[model samples]
Target: MTVFRLIITLLATSILGATEGVVTSNSVRLTDGETLASAMDKGALALNMGDVTFIAGYRQVTSIRQDPIIMRFDGQGSDAVKTWQRTDIDATAVDSRAVGLIWDGYERLYVLITVDGGSNDAGTVRRFTNNGWLRDYGSGGGPKVTVALRVDPNTGTPDTGTYIRARLSNGNTNSAVPTAIAFHGDTLVVQLSSFFSPLRVDRQRMTHDTGPSPFPWRVVFDPSLANARRSEAVNFDGVVDIPELPSRQVRLMVGDHEDASATVIVNQTVVARPSGSILDSGIYDPAAPCSFQLHDSIPSSLQ
Candidate 1:
């Protein structure tokens, strides 16, 4: 009789353990505009919307929604990507490109807008957070800036007589002015006018060698560097190594100088070529042959 009682007790204990292990599956279907709190109130461990799913864990909602909001301007043609509207005001413009979109985890979204016209005076970046719009104006005020270079193609040897020109986004240009040119340790520097600032230039890059035989060098601008801005002249402190060759050349190209109009300047010569014609010098023939023949033909290469 005691053994029978023991068997019955064991069976009861097993049933109790089974009941404790059981869990109720709690989930809720959410609409497009439902809050997380409402889903929690429904005893939901997960919320399923049309095409999105949010999982709840540790008393927190684990899903974030990020959708690009596009605004179209009237009379701006059908190309949606190239046009934009100002969130601050109800103004419509054309050729305003949406450059970037960013979402902050809590409740903020940012949109980077670029204007195609000469001088990005109309361009603005907007932030959407806390149910309102915020505008950010980039660096616009600074002292007059100038870039100078002291370039040495190789150790103990420095080249001379380099020329440079700057093109502004407003269709204005500063031609290859000898007075505006300066040098510093194997780098050619161009002194921009007082009106031009580093913030005004959207992008900058260097081309090792690409032009005519004498100074066969060019600087190609990378559009990706548009956001990279320097308030003052860029200092070259031997950070960028120069090739130890007489034919070694370097050119600096700045794109969208003066605004977001895609203005590009080609001739910002730094470091002169070794003395001697291209035919006479084997260095020019193989080491630095002209890559940009079409641009070489144009006296003042401006685009």
Candidate 2:
């Protein structure tokens, strides 16, 4: 038997932070009031809409309050795009943090949000059309509830209304929280997990079922945000992180173990293919091969 180990190390060569490069049209520069450093300090995220840049971040109002803000700047007039506000439904303890912004390249701009609902958090996907945000998406015009769908063997257009607001929760109110979200082609991949001690699924215990430990699971949704398909418990016992790949396939980092194993979910199918291992000090050991470092870099271009 051959074991494939995967390891990724992000290095920073600057004292300011880690630097990421994005090539955009010259017209897509930030206004004078905002700089790249300031955006990074605010934990802002930017998405390119046409030639313009759509920035999403939050402003700290009080210790327990934050206002989600969006800015549409094209080196010009008004930087304020729109202000978004949502009161907790049923007044049952709700807090939100912007996870990402998704644009369909035509009209819809989706905002991925995680709602902290005291005990169990939810992964909410909201849609903003050309007019404004769609408030009446779910029931009486709010977040659409999660439903069980027939898992199709292949992909096809969903037969339901466009899911302007979709929330992912599997009834486990104790800990089912959405940790991260990303786009796998046109499909949305959401990483979800509960609050419990995880039973590590290392090379030694891959065959045995680790029972009901908090191993991160995934839910894949189509472009409409409807027709969700859940995946099996990933063997690697860690929070799933979806990194960008040239192939645009969903890369699931196994866990923060020395083995550094990973599986790829291609297209919309849940498949695990172990990427090859590395030779560390000319010896083979599953628990001695993974290392990670985060470097926060500020771009000098100020865009």
Candidate 3:
């Protein structure tokens, strides 16, 4: 059997620290001054609406907290385009679940939504900025709750549109899932499962910026992998920083790669092996919780 390995080294400064938290309940309460209208202008309020939760890391809250309360934002303002209605959607009707919240160094908020209904397992990510909400591209037919957010090297801020990478399972007999994503400045590195093609890493520059008008997020892939439909892998249950790199590095694991196992290392280590091969792996940081259906398949070693 032949194995393909691709290694690329990038020169970058250490990664910045970020505030992280999760919202599992809808009991979050808001104070009198914490209405959506006021919070929108202040850009420093954390509110939870049903399955959606908003966290304002710019406010520099000493600690993260989710209170129980009912709050509403009535329509206001003449912008017409700017309605007081909240953009944080409640997906309970469809049985969707909130994975977690990530605050990048620039204080950009990214929310992961996992939809695991009788039909399919898929997900969507919403980026919250002072300007407004920016939705991201997502997959269908498989569980895609795993995600990773990296700072936009161009502006050094995520609001300007940070690099958002996600993975989903294709339910194929062969293990094909998005493995890892890494950002060094403006360049983005993405890894996915490829059946016929040789083992290789692809790079592309994409613009995730949004305007006042509604628009969907765009992802530009390297032309070489344009036909690589095997991007889907097992859902990632968690993410953590590689101790060696400490900063600017993260390891994502797919609990089970179709009975076999697999791992993707972004920035430093990128390896490709046949499906079902086992390798030494890192621990999953509970800080970054992901929603997927492969929980029962996680190897006993990783558990």
Candidate 4:
């Protein structure tokens, strides 16, 4: 999908037989100012002359210089998702993450990562051109969001959705709720799943307000996917097999738990404001003097 320009020898240090040839330290590289997002999203490729080291599913999370303490990319039976080999700067490996897409603009392939959130990790969003230069942005190489198909809120038809892959949060590693997500276009929608909080209006609260959702509404899987937009068909189990796709454009509100995390996922192009945005904000006011339900329910998760 991308080509190599030049690469740093150090970047090649992690190549355990994964590239065509190893990029030596003497390799000239592009300037650092070129943002990682622009490079990968633009179509940059690292220098991998011809080594078969790059397998489909290889991943890890830990300190780069300290060796990976955690890694995963194998599939379960026939349902496992395939992945690419990613090697960003050593310091960029501070958290659990995965490289999703690679788009290069200037004779290089850009690289992006999906990071795990926690008390220690700030999550990541690193980028590297074909030559293996590093540029950090969009969380620590974190995956952006993409694609969503919500209801009409009134008729329950195909309202519309966005595809910001960066919106989904998997730091839960066990399916925690992504607080908010952008639509397939340029909107946001969120689902408050299960949590330990008793005061917060979670799924139960959602049911009390509306009725129920097709699924639990808050239970999402935390899988290792790079460029979710490109691989969404596989994850969503709704499309045919395809090749690596363009990177998604989205962001995650950093934190954990209710008083800690800010995970959210949008299913449409309209921002779900319990209260609208600042211009006419009054949708989320539990005490607002308004008259609107805002949502409908399905048959599940209703107790």
Candidate 5:
């Protein structure tokens, strides 16, 4: 039997602090002060709606307190193109179950929702970004849920756009466990189990299982690189440092912005990937809350 050992190493690049990235929450008071003409409490889709706000949660069938809401923009100024709010849709390249609507630019409004919630697990992620509606991520079968899909002009069309995730498989929520997530070169160093030495997964495109469903796992492989970022932080007097030696996956809840230092809570979870396989474009489907692999750049040694 030929045993293959793959090594991944994320260099020790200490980021100054947490950078500006998208975070998930139940409700948000639009600080923009832009009073929407009307607001509906749908699900997570409410965030992308135009001239609208406050989407209500009708069928939040999950125990999690923070449920996703969908918002919609009425068809007043739109170029006669936009999904109708507070209405049901059929399975198509545009709107339906397992399908969604991702707002692209001035001429784009995507609708991603799933129609067949059964074994087929068919879903679509289509949008009108530049000029017409296009398929971004199609799903055959996997975890399904509607989430606020946030992306830039480049990632607006799905197909591994910005590498979105519902949750981090290797995360920390424990007070006693000390965790760390450091970026080295282009790789991400996930240190856990001090005695076992720090483990690293090379920069690759992989999918992470982060949905309201049962199966939750992290998948990693030498896929590709889309983008990368770096951040650093300082601990306060009472702040707890790494007590257990080495670990990865630490979550911090920053308080008010005025505070010089933020409150970072050490999350306890070892992120490991048993399969080092690269993901093809067809492996992932959009409109569902399934996790996915992010193609990132890293050192060749780890690959």
Candidate 6:
């Protein structure tokens, strides 16, 4: 009877809400010469819970050296409750910076990190649980690697079976770092500015047609980070939740376009583009009034 009671208690805690509040924002406080990975805006709380606050930013170790650090605060806000820095965990000489933070709404805190891969950036994601930093996710108990880049030779598609973060393209002019990350239900959504085409140039740099551009890439992974469900380019602005909406589906705002039209994404697969007639002429603005019509098929122009 005691063993049966223990099992029931464990199951309840596994799926129960452990915290009273969970808040996340790109706006974070920074000192002189300090910067965030990709701050959405400036001057706001990064992440706060009840009385404790967490901020992800850089610490200037020296005039030439900077390291990523997460500062925790208690009541006073004058001093840090705890400082979780990257150098404290990884002692390597490689250049790494903590860019962003994501809360699973549970006990796990995912840290979005980027390491300098020669001239470009290589993305890596790690998690902190009750047991502390998970150092055993990699080979021989190394740091956890969330973004993997391994493509098949023939098909040129990501091969999941033998994926590794170390296999990502290095020494590229363009960055392969993850710019943003958010949780879409049980799935983890990560955004990369560019992935495969390292030498890709815009219209300003006129040249022969290079390989296809795999930019604005979005990748979805399960909770365990063992399998990648899908990886492809997307047109959504960012991941957000609509408090007024009744549905529980993930809301992805699609407001980045040349015209006065915007798209909407409820699931990772479907996309809905608003009609131009319904919107006034001008560039698409997320802050403006808008509506969308769900279609069974995506327009060929967008595809």
lDDT of each: 0.22, 0.33, 0.27, 0.21, 0.23, 0.35
* Candidate 3 lDDT (Cα, 0 to 1): 0.27
Write one digit per residue (lDDT tens) for candidate 2, span 120-191.
223122222112122222222222121111111112111221212222233222333444445443445545
Per-residue lDDT, model 3, residue 139, is: 36
Position 298, candidate 2: lDDT:
29
Rank the candidate models, highest lDDT first.
Answer: 6, 2, 3, 5, 1, 4
Candidate 1 lDDT, 1-303, residue by residue in tens: 111000001111110111011011221333323344443465534323232223221111124311111222122113212123222210122222222222211111222222222223332112111111111222221111111111121121112111122333453332211112211212222223222212222333222222221121112111121121121222221213212222222232233221111211223221222221111011122222222222234432222
Residue 28, model 1: Cα distance from true site in angstroms: 36
Q: Which candidate ranks first by lDDT, i.e. highest?
A: 6
The number of clashing residue pairs in model 3 is 12
RMSD of each: 31.6, 16.8, 20.3, 23.3, 18.6, 18.4
**Backbone clashes in model 2, listed as residue pairs:** 5-277, 17-297, 18-296, 18-297, 136-141, 137-141, 138-142, 138-143, 138-144
Q: Give the higher-TM-score candidate: 4 or 5.
A: 5
Shift in Å, residue 151, candidate 6: 28
TM-scores, all models, native as reference: 0.19, 0.39, 0.26, 0.20, 0.24, 0.42
Supply the global lDDT for candidate 5. Answer: 0.23
Point out the worst 10-residue segment of candidate 3 by lDDT.
Answer: 230-239
Which candidate wins on TM-score? 6
Expressed as tens digits, the lDDT of each residue in 93-159 for candidate 5 is: 2222222332322322222222211222243222211111111222332323222223222222323
Superposed Cα deviation of residue 150, candidate 2 (Å): 22
Better of 1 and 6 by lDDT: 6
Which 10-residue window of candidate 2 scores lowest in summed lDDT? 149-158
